[model samples]
Target: MKMKLAATAIAAACALPLQASADGEVNIYSYRQAYLLEPLLNAFQEETGIETNVVFAKKGLAERLEREGRNSPADLVMTVDISRINELVERDLVEGIENDTLQNNIPQNLRHPDGKWFALTTRGRLIYASKERVEEGEITTYEQLADEKWDDRICTRSGKHPYNIALFSSMIAHHGEEATEEWLEGLKDNLARKPQGGDRDQIKAIHAGECDIAIGNSYYYGNMLNDENQREAAESVRLVFPNADGRGTHINISGIALTKSAPNRDNAIRLMEFLSEPKAQQIYAEANTEYPANPSVKPSGMVAEWGEINPDDLSLQEIAENRSAAVKMVDRVDYDN
Candidate 1:
């Protein structure tokens, strides 16, 4: 799998160059892997007369755009995580656009304050507890992962990974760095083994009885259930939307922004607006097993069965602002050690 992914990435990079958008065309530089974008792109092209062109890369599109300057062909950038999109804003690679469609479809908290980036779908950083061992209500908040009762029982990936960094950033947004530092230390103490593996491995750990609980994104539940080898392991655990009853779950997005030097600004804006509409959002969210940013669009059947999520009201603006401080706290606590 790793070899195939690396090969695919190399091929993608070899194929990518600054594309010049011609009339009625929009060029996209996306961090999202090709599989996730292909279907949506096809639908988008079919729906509108505008031609769609994409270059997929795992990383470094921002630097490429920077090097290309005003000559860059990218009309828009699509990527996951607030920090990644925020980097474009920080580096002046993307620009804010005032769009009534975005304003209507996306909530204020799920968008850039300056209208630079807008969330397309949301996923929660949630708890996965053993179905046999953890009772309903046994854990209620992200803070509970710190309790000593779970000592030597919890599991996670590296604290420095962007997903965890985003989660930690949210902590800073809510409780400040001092408290977040303490929380990280406690959370670390609960680890059953050294922090390691992707989110699905944590579910496999629960199935293997390596631990009674783990931390992961919500979408993995659907993915694991669909994989024949992972189905049983996925079934052995249940999800907890931590803090759902309080501040609501800590959620993040896969989002997009208009490039600063869009050659086809009008077509790019039209694409953005199309994506915000219910039909496109339905395809985008369902295929990814995520909640659409548009409230009117429902999640897939499997996702809906997991239960509704009430996302935290705290601004992603504040959360993105606190990311650097969050990473520092992880180091201070030696969280992955």
Candidate 2:
């Protein structure tokens, strides 16, 4: 089963530069978009003179690493969401990091317990409510999205999407399975149209009047607002930091991990530490509109304009642990149906 994925992923691996074996170079297998990574990598190279190579793909990376094993040229993996980074740990494809800079930069709750992965930036699972239809303060929490008042007034992407799954997992961590399942069922009952599209689509649905409220990540709002074409759709909605009055907003991360087969271990660690520092964290916040994992680095640009978000204090490890149960609950509710 795994080899099939690896075989298919070879096409992706072929996209990678073959010079990772060379000295003074760090190789990365990234799920992050190249546009977002380019600036950071450029700055890193300019600062340290260490060259970086990346193979960007949406899926099949973990299996690719597992297939390549010791011969793999990948020195590090950069990806978003707790589940993805944790998947590397679960497969034993990555190694635990032992660096003081990494430990000092990322908080305990955002990183793996055994030092296998460290988060770079976080995005809130925000509520995007139609400014015209939905009154301010009408919806304040994830629980409220399931309320009867929102019947046929909500839209979302697939419940199984990693972003939504992380939010659902956090819900499970807070409320347990039975209550969360009930909540999922209620949320499903509230859908305006069958759940469809990505996070940005949910916001666009609100602008189109197909739904009055939707769930999406905080960064998408900023991205849309900054774009020429999507600004109108983005402006139509107000960003709600769900559960700000209670348990706080649920957030997922873009994180990094060191591969077990790191051919450039020292350079990889250098890049990792560099990313954790203020300059790289600032680039992440400004360029990507994401909350920096390092508490010392504050969010900038439109993300900062949204004001401070009281992110849920739940450990990402707990969220990752509960993800399977969350997926099961989504299935039990038949959320995509």
Question: Which stretches in model 1 have alpha-carbon errors above 4 Å?
Answer: 1-7, 10-15
Q: What is the lDDT of residue 256 in candidate 2?
A: 97
> lDDT tens string, model 2, 184-222?
999999999998899999999999999999999999999
Tell me the spans in candidate 2 whose CA falls farther than 4 Å from its real position: 1-12, 15-17
What's every prediction's RMSD, in angstroms? Answer: 3.3, 4.2
Q: What TM-score goes with each of the models?
A: 0.95, 0.96
Query: Weakest 10 consecutive residues, lDDT, candidate 2?
Result: 1-10
Report, for every candidate in turn, its global Cα lDDT versus the true structure.
0.86, 0.89
Question: Per-residue lDDT for 301-322 in model 1, tens only?
Answer: 7889988998997888789888
Instruction: Give residue 230's lDDT in candidate 2 (0 to 100).
Output: 100
